[model samples]
Target: MSDGPTDLPAPREAPDAGPYWQAAREDRLVMQNCYGCGTYRFFPSLLCPECGSEEQVWGPCSGRGTIYSLTTVHRAPSPAFRKIVPYTVALIELEEGPRMMTNIVGEGRNEAAIGDAVEVCFEARGTDAKVPQFKLAGA
Candidate 1:
């Protein structure tokens, strides 16, 4: 199964996701920080869910988290994922308190477990291509 160096799907460029996408393209993980609510939000939203505030800033992430939940897809749901059968998808709880959906890569992808410590790494498929993925920390 292949989860790297392939024609992965291109991400949608929504207005609020501009900064996030730009950071990912450079192999950097970032999140929105709501100063009004003193909390962070993942997946990039224009409005803060904590206190319904729209004022925020882009903050860098440690890219370290624990696997809060996970699932292994033995059967590819779409053609883009066919080559990566048995891949692990995880809900990573970032150090900053926000959770995100992402894939586990490298050898860890095959053996990811709940509570496993992971660190973010970029998987670039081609020239000017980059996506954030994770691997078992110190594995």
Candidate 2:
């Protein structure tokens, strides 16, 4: 099984982050795209970092990336995460040119290698929670 808490703590949403999270709930991966500069930025913001434009748009992600960096957790950040010891925290370099931290999951969870190809897959929680997580490509 992919390592991590069975039920992740509910996400805390900020005003600027609403669209991103809403897209996730719909099982869609999106990034803040700068129309002026044609660059994508993460940790969503109203203004584009590259072009200083407030006219940014949410663009769909191919849900594809490469493992830029990673760590395998043998310990938990909190007692509630203890059950997920040995989970992976990775810096995924998305095809759109932004890197974000996310967990690596799937049958190859324990065998992730740097530079491994991955595709985004949604992890549904109960009824309304759908989180985009990375799995080995084609898994």
The lDDT per prediction is 0.83, 0.82
Summarize candidate 2's per-residue lDDT along 44-138 as a digit string, tens digits: 88788888988778999898999999999887878745766778989999999999888889888778989999999777654466667898898
Q: For candidate 1, what is the TM-score? A: 0.90
Compared with the true structure, model 2 gives a TM-score of 0.91
TM-score of each: 0.90, 0.91
Q: Report how far residue 10 has shifted in candidate 2, in Å.
A: 1.3
Off by over 4 Å in 1: 1-4, 125-127
